[model samples]
Target: MEDIAEAAAYGVAAPSAASSGAVRRPAAAPVAAGAPPGMAAAPAAPAPPMAGGLAAAAPPSAPRTAPPAEAAPVMGGVLQKEALGLVEIVPFRGVRRTMARHMAESVAKQAQVTTMDEADVTIIKRIREKERTVAAERGVRLTYLAFAIKACTAALKRFPRLNAVLKESGEEFVLKRYYNIGIAIDTKSGLVVPNIKAADTKSIFEIAAEIVDLVDRAEQRHLGVDELHGGTFTITNYGAIGGVYATPVINYPEVAILGMGRVRELPVVHEGKVLTRLLLPLSLTFDHQLIDGAEAARFLNLVMSYLEDPDLLLLEGA
Candidate 1:
Protein backbone atom coordinates (compact mmCIF):
# COMPACT_ATOMS: atom_id res chain seq x y z
CA MET A 1 0.00 0.00 0.00
CA GLU A 2 2.88 2.42 0.79
CA ASP A 3 4.64 1.84 -2.53
CA ILE A 4 1.37 2.35 -4.54
CA ALA A 5 0.75 5.68 -2.73
CA GLU A 6 4.25 6.96 -3.75
CA ALA A 7 3.75 5.94 -7.35
CA ALA A 8 0.39 7.78 -7.58
CA ALA A 9 1.97 10.97 -6.19
CA TYR A 10 4.72 10.89 -8.84
CA GLY A 11 2.11 10.51 -11.63
CA VAL A 12 0.22 13.65 -10.45
CA ALA A 13 3.52 15.61 -10.41
CA ALA A 14 4.51 14.62 -13.98
CA PRO A 15 2.78 17.48 -15.95
CA SER A 16 4.19 20.27 -13.72
CA ALA A 17 7.72 18.80 -13.98
CA ALA A 18 7.39 18.60 -17.84
CA SER A 19 6.13 22.26 -18.25
CA SER A 20 8.48 24.14 -15.87
CA GLY A 21 11.39 21.62 -15.69
CA ALA A 22 11.31 21.95 -11.93
CA VAL A 23 10.45 19.57 -9.19
CA ARG A 24 8.62 20.39 -5.95
CA ARG A 25 7.48 18.36 -3.04
CA PRO A 26 5.69 19.46 0.06
CA ALA A 27 7.62 18.92 3.29
CA ALA A 28 4.47 17.32 4.78
CA ALA A 29 4.21 13.53 4.34
CA PRO A 30 1.88 12.29 1.50
CA VAL A 31 -1.78 11.25 2.22
CA ALA A 32 -2.62 7.61 1.65
CA ALA A 33 -5.73 8.27 -0.56
CA GLY A 34 -4.07 9.91 -3.54
CA ALA A 35 -5.91 12.38 -5.80
CA PRO A 36 -8.82 10.61 -7.67
CA PRO A 37 -8.03 9.06 -11.06
CA GLY A 38 -8.11 11.36 -14.19
CA MET A 39 -8.61 14.47 -11.92
CA ALA A 40 -5.89 17.22 -11.79
CA ALA A 41 -4.07 17.44 -8.43
CA ALA A 42 -3.34 20.72 -6.78
CA PRO A 43 0.20 21.82 -7.73
CA ALA A 44 2.77 21.02 -5.10
CA ALA A 45 3.64 23.95 -2.83
CA PRO A 46 7.06 24.96 -4.27
CA ALA A 47 10.27 24.44 -2.23
CA PRO A 48 10.68 27.86 -0.54
CA PRO A 49 14.45 28.63 -0.78
CA MET A 50 14.88 28.35 -4.60
CA ALA A 51 11.48 29.97 -5.60
CA GLY A 52 12.67 33.59 -5.21
CA GLY A 53 15.88 32.90 -7.25
CA LEU A 54 13.85 31.41 -10.19
CA ALA A 55 11.47 34.43 -10.41
CA ALA A 56 14.36 36.97 -10.31
CA ALA A 57 16.44 35.22 -13.08
CA ALA A 58 13.63 35.37 -15.78
CA PRO A 59 14.13 38.10 -18.55
CA PRO A 60 11.41 40.73 -19.19
CA SER A 61 9.21 40.00 -22.28
CA ALA A 62 9.32 42.10 -25.50
CA PRO A 63 6.34 44.29 -26.56
CA ARG A 64 3.61 42.88 -28.88
CA THR A 65 4.28 42.89 -32.70
CA ALA A 66 2.36 45.22 -35.14
CA PRO A 67 -0.23 43.87 -37.62
CA PRO A 68 0.85 42.78 -41.17
CA ALA A 69 1.09 45.29 -44.11
CA GLU A 70 -1.56 43.52 -46.30
CA ALA A 71 -4.43 45.48 -44.70
CA ALA A 72 -6.22 47.98 -47.19
CA PRO A 73 -5.30 51.74 -47.29
CA VAL A 74 -7.83 53.99 -45.52
CA MET A 75 -9.88 56.12 -48.04
CA GLY A 76 -12.90 58.52 -48.00
CA GLY A 77 -14.96 61.01 -50.11
CA VAL A 78 -13.48 64.04 -48.26
CA LEU A 79 -10.30 64.11 -50.42
CA GLN A 80 -12.32 64.24 -53.70
CA LYS A 81 -14.58 66.96 -52.35
CA GLU A 82 -11.57 69.17 -51.50
CA ALA A 83 -10.04 68.78 -55.00
CA LEU A 84 -13.30 69.81 -56.80
CA GLY A 85 -13.87 72.95 -54.69
CA LEU A 86 -10.67 74.78 -55.79
CA VAL A 87 -10.92 77.90 -58.04
CA GLU A 88 -8.35 78.67 -60.74
CA ILE A 89 -7.20 82.01 -62.17
CA VAL A 90 -5.45 82.02 -65.53
CA PRO A 91 -3.04 84.86 -66.36
CA PHE A 92 -1.53 85.63 -69.76
CA ARG A 93 0.87 88.17 -71.31
CA GLY A 94 -1.00 90.96 -73.19
CA VAL A 95 -0.39 92.39 -76.68
CA ARG A 96 0.33 95.80 -75.21
CA ARG A 97 3.28 96.58 -77.55
CA THR A 98 1.11 96.27 -80.67
CA MET A 99 -1.62 98.36 -79.12
CA ALA A 100 0.87 101.07 -78.20
CA ARG A 101 2.44 101.16 -81.68
CA HIS A 102 -0.96 101.54 -83.35
CA MET A 103 -1.90 104.38 -81.05
CA ALA A 104 1.31 106.27 -81.82
CA GLU A 105 0.97 105.61 -85.57
CA SER A 106 -2.63 106.88 -85.60
CA VAL A 107 -1.48 110.24 -84.26
CA ALA A 108 1.36 110.52 -86.81
CA LYS A 109 -0.06 108.86 -89.95
CA GLN A 110 -3.50 110.41 -90.12
CA ALA A 111 -4.45 110.67 -93.85
CA GLN A 112 -7.18 113.23 -93.30
CA VAL A 113 -7.13 116.12 -90.86
CA THR A 114 -9.72 116.43 -88.07
CA THR A 115 -13.20 117.80 -88.97
CA MET A 116 -14.96 120.54 -87.00
CA ASP A 117 -18.69 120.77 -86.32
CA GLU A 118 -20.69 123.14 -84.10
CA ALA A 119 -23.48 121.62 -81.99
CA ASP A 120 -26.00 123.76 -80.08
CA VAL A 121 -26.05 121.92 -76.75
CA THR A 122 -28.00 124.75 -75.02
CA ILE A 123 -30.97 122.56 -74.00
CA ILE A 124 -28.75 119.66 -72.98
CA LYS A 125 -26.46 122.00 -71.08
CA ARG A 126 -29.41 123.40 -69.14
CA ILE A 127 -30.57 119.92 -68.18
CA ARG A 128 -27.06 119.07 -66.99
CA GLU A 129 -26.99 122.22 -64.87
CA LYS A 130 -30.19 121.07 -63.12
CA GLU A 131 -29.06 117.43 -62.77
CA ARG A 132 -25.58 118.25 -61.49
CA THR A 133 -26.99 119.98 -58.41
CA VAL A 134 -29.29 117.04 -57.64
CA ALA A 135 -26.46 114.58 -58.27
CA ALA A 136 -24.08 116.53 -56.03
CA GLU A 137 -26.56 116.28 -53.17
CA ARG A 138 -26.39 112.51 -53.44
CA GLY A 139 -22.55 112.44 -53.51
CA VAL A 140 -22.30 111.85 -57.27
CA ARG A 141 -20.87 114.24 -59.82
CA LEU A 142 -22.67 114.04 -63.17
CA THR A 143 -20.45 114.67 -66.19
CA TYR A 144 -21.06 115.19 -69.93
CA LEU A 145 -20.09 111.53 -70.49
CA ALA A 146 -23.60 110.49 -69.40
CA PHE A 147 -25.18 112.61 -72.10
CA ALA A 148 -22.64 111.52 -74.72
CA ILE A 149 -23.16 107.84 -73.98
CA LYS A 150 -26.93 108.26 -74.19
CA ALA A 151 -26.68 110.20 -77.48
CA CYS A 152 -24.32 107.59 -78.92
CA THR A 153 -26.72 104.77 -77.98
CA ALA A 154 -29.57 106.49 -79.85
CA ALA A 155 -27.37 107.21 -82.87
CA LEU A 156 -26.10 103.61 -82.95
CA LYS A 157 -29.71 102.36 -83.22
CA ARG A 158 -30.09 104.51 -86.31
CA PHE A 159 -26.79 103.24 -87.80
CA PRO A 160 -26.19 99.68 -86.62
CA ARG A 161 -23.34 99.01 -89.05
CA LEU A 162 -21.30 101.80 -87.46
CA ASN A 163 -21.04 99.45 -84.47
CA ALA A 164 -19.84 96.56 -86.69
CA VAL A 165 -16.32 95.17 -87.01
CA LEU A 166 -14.34 94.44 -90.21
CA LYS A 167 -13.10 90.87 -90.42
CA GLU A 168 -11.03 90.03 -93.56
CA SER A 169 -11.15 86.27 -93.87
CA GLY A 170 -10.73 85.49 -97.65
CA GLU A 171 -11.66 89.05 -98.71
CA GLU A 172 -15.00 89.31 -96.88
CA PHE A 173 -16.34 91.29 -93.93
CA VAL A 174 -18.16 89.57 -91.08
CA LEU A 175 -20.49 91.77 -89.04
CA LYS A 176 -20.96 90.75 -85.44
CA ARG A 177 -24.25 90.69 -83.48
CA TYR A 178 -23.21 92.32 -80.21
CA TYR A 179 -22.41 96.00 -79.71
CA ASN A 180 -19.48 96.61 -77.32
CA ILE A 181 -18.48 100.27 -76.97
CA GLY A 182 -14.85 100.80 -75.90
CA ILE A 183 -13.84 103.99 -74.15
CA ALA A 184 -10.16 104.91 -74.65
CA ILE A 185 -8.47 105.86 -71.40
CA ASP A 186 -4.96 107.34 -71.22
CA THR A 187 -3.36 105.71 -68.21
CA LYS A 188 -0.01 106.64 -66.69
CA SER A 189 1.55 103.55 -68.30
CA GLY A 190 -0.13 103.97 -71.70
CA LEU A 191 -3.59 103.81 -73.33
CA VAL A 192 -6.14 101.03 -72.75
CA VAL A 193 -9.60 100.47 -74.27
CA PRO A 194 -11.84 98.80 -71.72
CA ASN A 195 -15.20 98.28 -73.44
CA ILE A 196 -18.65 98.30 -71.94
CA LYS A 197 -20.65 95.18 -72.84
CA ALA A 198 -24.18 95.55 -74.23
CA ALA A 199 -24.04 99.33 -74.19
CA ASP A 200 -27.41 99.71 -75.93
CA THR A 201 -29.25 98.00 -73.07
CA LYS A 202 -27.89 100.22 -70.30
CA SER A 203 -29.29 103.62 -69.33
CA ILE A 204 -27.34 106.89 -69.45
CA PHE A 205 -26.79 106.77 -65.68
CA GLU A 206 -25.52 103.21 -65.83
CA ILE A 207 -23.09 103.93 -68.66
CA ALA A 208 -21.76 106.93 -66.82
CA ALA A 209 -21.28 104.84 -63.69
CA GLU A 210 -19.47 102.13 -65.61
CA ILE A 211 -17.16 104.62 -67.28
CA VAL A 212 -16.28 106.20 -63.95
CA ASP A 213 -15.61 102.84 -62.33
CA LEU A 214 -13.49 101.55 -65.21
CA VAL A 215 -11.47 104.74 -65.50
CA ASP A 216 -10.81 104.71 -61.76
CA ARG A 217 -9.62 101.11 -61.86
CA ALA A 218 -7.52 101.75 -64.97
CA GLU A 219 -5.74 104.66 -63.34
CA GLN A 220 -4.94 102.45 -60.36
CA ARG A 221 -3.40 99.78 -62.66
CA HIS A 222 -5.90 97.21 -61.42
CA LEU A 223 -7.83 96.54 -64.66
CA GLY A 224 -8.87 92.88 -65.03
CA VAL A 225 -8.33 90.68 -68.12
CA ASP A 226 -11.93 90.95 -69.31
CA GLU A 227 -11.71 94.77 -69.30
CA LEU A 228 -8.83 94.76 -71.82
CA HIS A 229 -10.48 92.71 -74.57
CA GLY A 230 -13.46 92.59 -77.00
CA GLY A 231 -14.45 95.92 -78.53
CA THR A 232 -16.80 96.60 -81.50
CA PHE A 233 -16.76 100.43 -81.47
CA THR A 234 -14.57 102.99 -79.73
CA ILE A 235 -14.71 106.60 -78.47
CA THR A 236 -11.60 108.65 -77.69
CA ASN A 237 -12.23 111.85 -75.76
CA TYR A 238 -9.34 114.04 -76.80
CA GLY A 239 -11.41 117.09 -75.82
CA ALA A 240 -10.04 116.94 -72.29
CA ILE A 241 -6.56 117.83 -73.60
CA GLY A 242 -7.73 120.97 -75.53
CA GLY A 243 -7.44 119.38 -78.96
CA VAL A 244 -9.80 121.01 -81.45
CA TYR A 245 -9.76 117.96 -83.69
CA ALA A 246 -7.91 114.67 -84.04
CA THR A 247 -8.04 111.89 -86.61
CA PRO A 248 -8.22 109.11 -84.03
CA VAL A 249 -7.01 105.67 -85.05
CA ILE A 250 -9.48 102.96 -85.97
CA ASN A 251 -9.29 100.57 -83.01
CA TYR A 252 -8.27 97.54 -85.12
CA PRO A 253 -10.89 95.05 -86.32
CA GLU A 254 -13.60 97.64 -85.63
CA VAL A 255 -15.29 99.53 -88.43
CA ALA A 256 -15.45 102.96 -86.80
CA ILE A 257 -14.03 105.16 -84.04
CA LEU A 258 -15.32 108.60 -82.97
CA GLY A 259 -13.17 111.43 -81.64
CA MET A 260 -14.49 114.22 -79.44
CA GLY A 261 -12.64 117.56 -79.38
CA ARG A 262 -12.62 120.51 -77.02
CA VAL A 263 -15.83 122.45 -76.63
CA ARG A 264 -15.11 126.16 -77.08
CA GLU A 265 -17.02 129.38 -77.76
CA LEU A 266 -16.59 130.26 -81.46
CA PRO A 267 -18.07 132.79 -83.86
CA VAL A 268 -20.51 131.28 -86.32
CA VAL A 269 -22.89 132.75 -88.88
CA HIS A 270 -26.46 131.94 -87.83
CA GLU A 271 -28.33 133.80 -90.59
CA GLY A 272 -26.05 136.56 -91.97
CA LYS A 273 -24.34 138.01 -88.88
CA VAL A 274 -21.56 136.37 -86.88
CA LEU A 275 -22.67 134.99 -83.50
CA THR A 276 -20.66 133.43 -80.67
CA ARG A 277 -21.88 129.88 -79.94
CA LEU A 278 -20.54 126.79 -78.19
CA LEU A 279 -18.92 124.52 -80.81
CA LEU A 280 -17.37 121.01 -80.57
CA PRO A 281 -14.99 119.47 -83.07
CA LEU A 282 -15.77 115.93 -84.21
CA SER A 283 -13.74 113.34 -86.15
CA LEU A 284 -14.81 109.95 -87.46
CA THR A 285 -12.45 107.27 -88.84
CA PHE A 286 -14.09 104.29 -90.53
CA ASP A 287 -12.65 101.16 -92.07
CA HIS A 288 -13.02 101.30 -95.86
CA GLN A 289 -13.64 97.54 -95.88
CA LEU A 290 -17.27 97.70 -94.68
CA ILE A 291 -18.28 101.41 -94.47
CA ASP A 292 -18.52 103.72 -97.52
CA GLY A 293 -18.12 107.51 -97.51
CA ALA A 294 -21.87 108.05 -97.88
CA GLU A 295 -22.71 105.68 -95.04
CA ALA A 296 -20.05 107.21 -92.82
CA ALA A 297 -21.36 110.69 -93.53
CA ARG A 298 -24.91 109.60 -92.71
CA PHE A 299 -23.78 108.03 -89.43
CA LEU A 300 -21.97 111.23 -88.49
CA ASN A 301 -25.11 113.17 -89.31
CA LEU A 302 -27.10 110.94 -86.93
CA VAL A 303 -24.54 111.50 -84.15
CA MET A 304 -24.61 115.27 -84.79
CA SER A 305 -28.39 115.29 -84.69
CA TYR A 306 -28.40 113.55 -81.31
CA LEU A 307 -25.83 115.97 -79.89
CA GLU A 308 -27.58 119.08 -81.26
CA ASP A 309 -30.92 118.01 -79.83
CA PRO A 310 -29.75 116.19 -76.69
CA ASP A 311 -33.27 116.70 -75.23
CA LEU A 312 -34.56 114.47 -78.01
CA LEU A 313 -32.38 111.65 -76.62
CA LEU A 314 -34.07 111.97 -73.21
CA LEU A 315 -37.48 112.04 -74.86
CA GLU A 316 -36.55 109.10 -77.12
CA GLY A 317 -36.34 106.73 -74.07
CA ALA A 318 -32.55 106.48 -73.88
Candidate 2:
Protein backbone atom coordinates (compact mmCIF):
# COMPACT_ATOMS: atom_id res chain seq x y z
CA MET A 1 0.00 0.00 0.00
CA GLU A 2 1.00 3.64 -0.09
CA ASP A 3 2.68 3.56 3.32
CA ILE A 4 4.81 0.49 2.42
CA ALA A 5 5.78 2.07 -0.96
CA GLU A 6 6.76 5.32 0.79
CA ALA A 7 9.01 3.39 3.18
CA ALA A 8 10.57 1.43 0.28
CA ALA A 9 11.28 4.69 -1.66
CA TYR A 10 13.49 5.92 1.20
CA GLY A 11 15.34 2.50 1.31
CA VAL A 12 13.77 1.63 4.68
CA ALA A 13 12.20 -1.76 5.48
CA ALA A 14 8.54 -1.76 4.34
CA PRO A 15 5.82 -2.41 6.90
CA SER A 16 3.50 -5.43 6.37
CA ALA A 17 -0.08 -4.81 5.10
CA ALA A 18 -1.42 -5.82 8.55
CA SER A 19 0.69 -3.12 10.30
CA SER A 20 0.51 -0.38 7.54
CA GLY A 21 2.61 1.95 9.76
CA ALA A 22 4.91 4.52 8.06
CA VAL A 23 8.60 3.62 8.55
CA ARG A 24 11.13 6.41 8.81
CA ARG A 25 14.77 6.42 7.64
CA PRO A 26 17.26 8.34 9.80
CA ALA A 27 19.55 10.85 8.03
CA ALA A 28 23.19 9.73 8.02
CA ALA A 29 25.71 12.12 9.63
CA PRO A 30 27.89 14.17 7.23
CA VAL A 31 31.54 13.28 7.28
CA ALA A 32 33.75 15.96 8.80
CA ALA A 33 36.76 17.26 6.86
CA GLY A 34 40.19 15.93 7.84
CA ALA A 35 38.69 12.93 9.60
CA PRO A 36 40.98 10.39 11.25
CA PRO A 37 42.52 7.74 9.03
CA GLY A 38 40.39 4.77 7.78
CA MET A 39 37.13 6.78 7.85
CA ALA A 40 34.92 7.58 4.80
CA ALA A 41 31.89 9.81 4.16
CA ALA A 42 28.40 8.22 3.91
CA PRO A 43 26.59 8.03 0.58
CA ALA A 44 23.64 10.42 -0.11
CA ALA A 45 20.20 8.90 0.48
CA PRO A 46 17.68 8.42 -2.43
CA ALA A 47 14.92 11.00 -2.97
CA PRO A 48 11.40 10.50 -1.45
CA PRO A 49 8.31 9.69 -3.54
CA MET A 50 6.07 12.65 -4.72
CA ALA A 51 2.28 12.77 -4.48
CA GLY A 52 1.69 11.53 -8.10
CA GLY A 53 4.01 8.50 -7.39
CA LEU A 54 6.90 10.22 -9.16
CA ALA A 55 10.17 10.21 -7.18
CA ALA A 56 11.65 13.67 -6.34
CA ALA A 57 15.09 14.66 -7.57
CA ALA A 58 17.93 13.15 -5.56
CA PRO A 59 20.35 15.41 -3.62
CA PRO A 60 23.92 15.82 -4.92
CA SER A 61 26.30 13.04 -3.86
CA ALA A 62 29.31 13.66 -1.57
CA PRO A 63 32.65 14.15 -3.32
CA ARG A 64 34.83 11.07 -3.42
CA THR A 65 37.60 11.03 -0.82
CA ALA A 66 41.24 10.53 -1.81
CA PRO A 67 43.06 7.39 -0.77
CA PRO A 68 45.21 7.58 2.37
CA ALA A 69 48.58 9.31 1.85
CA GLU A 70 50.56 6.22 2.83
CA ALA A 71 48.68 3.97 0.38
CA ALA A 72 48.94 6.21 -2.72
CA PRO A 73 52.62 6.06 -3.74
CA VAL A 74 52.67 3.95 -6.92
CA MET A 75 49.35 2.35 -5.73
CA GLY A 76 51.12 0.15 -3.17
CA GLY A 77 53.42 -1.51 -5.77
CA VAL A 78 50.38 -2.62 -7.79
CA LEU A 79 51.55 -0.21 -10.51
CA GLN A 80 55.20 -1.35 -10.17
CA LYS A 81 55.19 -4.91 -11.51
CA GLU A 82 58.78 -4.64 -12.68
CA ALA A 83 60.02 -5.61 -9.23
CA LEU A 84 57.64 -8.59 -8.96
CA GLY A 85 58.73 -10.06 -12.30
CA LEU A 86 62.13 -10.84 -13.79
CA VAL A 87 63.29 -7.48 -15.14
CA GLU A 88 66.88 -8.28 -16.05
CA ILE A 89 69.68 -10.43 -14.71
CA VAL A 90 73.18 -9.00 -14.81
CA PRO A 91 75.72 -11.08 -12.88
CA PHE A 92 78.97 -9.54 -11.64
CA ARG A 93 81.76 -9.79 -14.18
CA GLY A 94 85.57 -9.36 -14.20
CA VAL A 95 86.62 -6.57 -11.82
CA ARG A 96 83.09 -6.28 -10.44
CA ARG A 97 83.17 -9.97 -9.47
CA THR A 98 86.62 -9.58 -7.92
CA MET A 99 85.43 -6.57 -5.93
CA ALA A 100 82.33 -8.41 -4.73
CA ARG A 101 84.35 -11.40 -3.53
CA HIS A 102 86.97 -9.23 -1.78
CA MET A 103 84.35 -7.08 -0.07
CA ALA A 104 82.49 -10.14 1.18
CA GLU A 105 85.70 -11.79 2.36
CA SER A 106 86.76 -8.61 4.15
CA VAL A 107 83.41 -8.40 5.98
CA ALA A 108 83.47 -12.09 6.92
CA LYS A 109 87.06 -12.04 8.18
CA GLN A 110 87.26 -8.77 10.15
CA ALA A 111 85.35 -7.59 13.23
CA GLN A 112 84.87 -3.96 12.16
CA VAL A 113 84.51 -1.05 14.60
CA THR A 114 83.89 2.48 13.37
CA THR A 115 84.70 5.73 15.17
CA MET A 116 83.73 9.21 13.92
CA ASP A 117 85.22 12.65 14.57
CA GLU A 118 85.45 16.13 13.03
CA ALA A 119 88.57 18.29 12.64
CA ASP A 120 88.97 22.07 12.32
CA VAL A 121 91.00 22.45 9.09
CA THR A 122 90.59 26.20 8.54
CA ILE A 123 94.38 26.82 8.68
CA ILE A 124 95.09 23.89 6.35
CA LYS A 125 92.53 25.23 3.85
CA ARG A 126 94.15 28.67 3.97
CA ILE A 127 97.60 27.12 3.46
CA ARG A 128 96.32 25.17 0.42
CA GLU A 129 94.91 28.38 -1.11
CA LYS A 130 98.28 30.12 -0.75
CA GLU A 131 100.24 27.12 -2.11
CA ARG A 132 97.84 26.32 -4.96
CA THR A 133 99.76 28.43 -7.47
CA VAL A 134 103.13 27.07 -6.32
CA ALA A 135 101.77 23.52 -6.67
CA ALA A 136 100.49 24.37 -10.17
CA GLU A 137 103.97 25.65 -11.12
CA ARG A 138 105.40 22.24 -10.21
CA GLY A 139 102.67 20.44 -12.27
CA VAL A 140 101.11 19.12 -9.04
CA ARG A 141 97.47 19.74 -8.18
CA LEU A 142 97.20 20.62 -4.49
CA THR A 143 94.32 18.84 -2.72
CA TYR A 144 93.05 18.17 0.76
CA LEU A 145 93.60 14.47 0.04
CA ALA A 146 97.35 15.03 -0.38
CA PHE A 147 97.42 16.69 3.04
CA ALA A 148 95.35 13.85 4.48
CA ILE A 149 97.74 11.24 3.03
CA LYS A 150 100.66 13.01 4.68
CA ALA A 151 98.81 13.22 7.98
CA CYS A 152 97.73 9.58 7.84
CA THR A 153 101.27 8.30 7.15
CA ALA A 154 102.56 10.32 10.11
CA ALA A 155 99.80 8.92 12.32
CA LEU A 156 100.49 5.39 11.13
CA LYS A 157 104.17 5.78 12.03
CA ARG A 158 103.17 7.16 15.44
CA PHE A 159 100.53 4.46 16.01
CA PRO A 160 102.08 1.47 14.30
CA ARG A 161 99.41 -0.90 15.62
CA LEU A 162 96.85 0.62 13.24
CA ASN A 163 99.21 -0.07 10.32
CA ALA A 164 99.58 -3.75 11.23
CA VAL A 165 97.88 -6.93 10.00
CA LEU A 166 96.75 -9.98 11.98
CA LYS A 167 98.27 -13.29 10.88
CA GLU A 168 95.93 -15.81 9.23
CA SER A 169 96.92 -18.42 11.87
CA GLY A 170 95.59 -16.13 14.63
CA GLU A 171 98.79 -16.58 16.61
CA GLU A 172 100.55 -13.23 16.00
CA PHE A 173 100.24 -9.93 14.08
CA VAL A 174 102.79 -8.16 11.87
CA LEU A 175 103.63 -4.45 12.17
CA LYS A 176 104.91 -3.26 8.80
CA ARG A 177 108.14 -1.26 9.09
CA TYR A 178 107.65 0.62 5.80
CA TYR A 179 104.58 2.66 4.90
CA ASN A 180 102.93 1.56 1.66
CA ILE A 181 99.78 3.64 1.99
CA GLY A 182 96.85 2.60 -0.22
CA ILE A 183 94.76 5.25 -1.91
CA ALA A 184 91.39 3.83 -3.01
CA ILE A 185 90.17 5.11 -6.36
CA ASP A 186 86.92 4.60 -8.27
CA THR A 187 87.43 3.53 -11.87
CA LYS A 188 84.97 2.49 -14.59
CA SER A 189 85.46 -1.17 -13.70
CA GLY A 190 85.27 -0.86 -9.92
CA LEU A 191 87.35 0.31 -6.93
CA VAL A 192 91.14 0.18 -7.31
CA VAL A 193 93.55 0.57 -4.40
CA PRO A 194 97.08 1.43 -5.56
CA ASN A 195 99.54 2.11 -2.79
CA ILE A 196 102.42 4.56 -2.72
CA LYS A 197 105.68 2.80 -1.82
CA ALA A 198 107.39 4.34 1.23
CA ALA A 199 104.61 6.92 1.58
CA ASP A 200 106.05 8.05 4.95
CA THR A 201 109.24 9.22 3.27
CA LYS A 202 107.45 11.18 0.51
CA SER A 203 106.87 14.95 0.79
CA ILE A 204 103.37 16.45 0.35
CA PHE A 205 104.12 17.61 -3.22
CA GLU A 206 105.67 14.24 -4.15
CA ILE A 207 102.65 12.39 -2.72
CA ALA A 208 100.29 14.69 -4.64
CA ALA A 209 102.11 13.99 -7.92
CA GLU A 210 102.14 10.22 -7.23
CA ILE A 211 98.42 10.34 -6.43
CA VAL A 212 97.70 11.89 -9.83
CA ASP A 213 99.85 9.32 -11.66
CA LEU A 214 98.34 6.41 -9.68
CA VAL A 215 94.79 7.58 -10.34
CA ASP A 216 95.41 8.01 -14.08
CA ARG A 217 97.14 4.63 -14.33
CA ALA A 218 94.48 2.96 -12.19
CA GLU A 219 91.68 4.21 -14.42
CA GLN A 220 93.59 2.94 -17.46
CA ARG A 221 94.08 -0.50 -15.74
CA HIS A 222 97.83 -0.14 -16.34
CA LEU A 223 98.90 -0.40 -12.67
CA GLY A 224 101.25 -3.26 -11.77
CA VAL A 225 100.28 -6.03 -9.32
CA ASP A 226 102.93 -4.62 -6.94
CA GLU A 227 100.94 -1.35 -6.88
CA LEU A 228 97.72 -3.23 -5.95
CA HIS A 229 99.23 -5.42 -3.24
CA GLY A 230 101.53 -4.65 -0.25
CA GLY A 231 99.27 -1.94 1.18
CA THR A 232 100.13 -1.53 4.89
CA PHE A 233 97.35 1.01 5.41
CA THR A 234 94.47 2.36 3.29
CA ILE A 235 92.71 5.74 2.93
CA THR A 236 89.52 6.46 1.01
CA ASN A 237 88.29 10.03 0.41
CA TYR A 238 84.52 9.75 0.10
CA GLY A 239 84.52 13.55 0.57
CA ALA A 240 85.29 13.92 -3.14
CA ILE A 241 81.83 12.47 -3.84
CA GLY A 242 80.13 14.66 -1.17
CA GLY A 243 79.64 12.01 1.51
CA VAL A 244 79.62 13.56 5.00
CA TYR A 245 80.30 10.45 7.09
CA ALA A 246 80.26 6.69 6.56
CA THR A 247 81.24 3.42 8.24
CA PRO A 248 83.73 2.38 5.57
CA VAL A 249 84.77 -1.25 5.32
CA ILE A 250 88.40 -2.23 5.93
CA ASN A 251 90.62 -3.35 3.06
CA TYR A 252 91.13 -6.89 4.37
CA PRO A 253 94.49 -8.00 5.78
CA GLU A 254 95.09 -4.35 6.67
CA VAL A 255 94.04 -3.69 10.29
CA ALA A 256 92.45 -0.31 9.58
CA ILE A 257 91.11 2.04 6.93
CA LEU A 258 90.62 5.81 7.09
CA GLY A 259 87.55 7.43 5.47
CA MET A 260 87.52 11.20 4.90
CA GLY A 261 84.26 13.10 4.52
CA ARG A 262 83.48 16.49 2.96
CA VAL A 263 84.81 19.68 4.57
CA ARG A 264 81.99 21.97 5.69
CA GLU A 265 82.37 25.49 7.11
CA LEU A 266 80.37 25.98 10.30
CA PRO A 267 80.42 28.29 13.33
CA VAL A 268 82.59 27.20 16.25
CA VAL A 269 83.77 28.60 19.59
CA HIS A 270 87.49 29.28 19.20
CA GLU A 271 89.40 31.40 21.74
CA GLY A 272 86.15 32.79 23.26
CA LYS A 273 85.04 34.09 19.85
CA VAL A 274 82.32 32.60 17.63
CA LEU A 275 83.90 32.17 14.21
CA THR A 276 83.29 30.07 11.13
CA ARG A 277 85.88 27.37 10.41
CA LEU A 278 86.33 24.62 7.81
CA LEU A 279 85.69 21.28 9.52
CA LEU A 280 86.48 17.89 7.99
CA PRO A 281 84.58 14.80 9.09
CA LEU A 282 86.55 11.59 9.57
CA SER A 283 85.56 7.92 9.97
CA LEU A 284 87.98 5.24 11.09
CA THR A 285 87.02 1.61 10.60
CA PHE A 286 89.42 -0.90 12.10
CA ASP A 287 89.63 -4.62 12.77
CA HIS A 288 88.61 -4.92 16.42
CA GLN A 289 90.60 -8.18 16.74
CA LEU A 290 93.82 -6.25 16.06
CA ILE A 291 93.16 -2.66 17.18
CA ASP A 292 91.31 -1.52 20.31
CA GLY A 293 88.83 1.39 20.25
CA ALA A 294 91.07 3.60 22.40
CA GLU A 295 94.05 2.96 20.15
CA ALA A 296 91.96 3.83 17.07
CA ALA A 297 90.74 7.07 18.67
CA ARG A 298 94.32 8.15 19.44
CA PHE A 299 95.39 7.38 15.87
CA LEU A 300 92.55 9.50 14.48
CA ASN A 301 93.40 12.30 16.91
CA LEU A 302 97.04 12.30 15.75
CA VAL A 303 95.93 12.53 12.10
CA MET A 304 93.63 15.43 12.98
CA SER A 305 96.43 17.19 14.85
CA TYR A 306 98.63 17.21 11.72
CA LEU A 307 95.67 18.45 9.65
CA GLU A 308 94.69 21.17 12.16
CA ASP A 309 98.28 22.45 12.21
CA PRO A 310 99.95 22.14 8.80
CA ASP A 311 103.13 23.05 10.66
CA LEU A 312 103.22 19.57 12.21
CA LEU A 313 103.17 18.04 8.72
CA LEU A 314 106.16 20.13 7.60
CA LEU A 315 108.03 19.21 10.79
CA GLU A 316 107.29 15.53 10.06
CA GLY A 317 108.91 15.88 6.57
CA ALA A 318 105.54 16.30 4.76
lDDT of residue 69 for candidate 1 = 33
TM for candidate 1 is 0.63
> What is candidate 1's local distance difference test score?
0.63
lDDT of 2 by residue, 135-205 (tens): 99988987888888889988888899988889998899999998998998997766768899998888889
Collision count of model 1 = 0
Top of the candidates by TM-score: 2
- lDDT (tens digit, per residue) of candidate 1 on 222-300: 6665666688788888898778777788777666788888878778886698987777677888765566677778877
The global C-alpha lDDT for each of the candidates, from Candidate 1 onward, is 0.63, 0.79
Inter-residue clash pairs, candidate 1: none
Best candidate per lDDT, number? 2
TM-score of each model, in listed order = 0.63, 0.73
Report the Cα lDDT for residue 187, model 2. 76
Single out the weakest 10-residue window by summed lDDT for candidate 2: 11-20
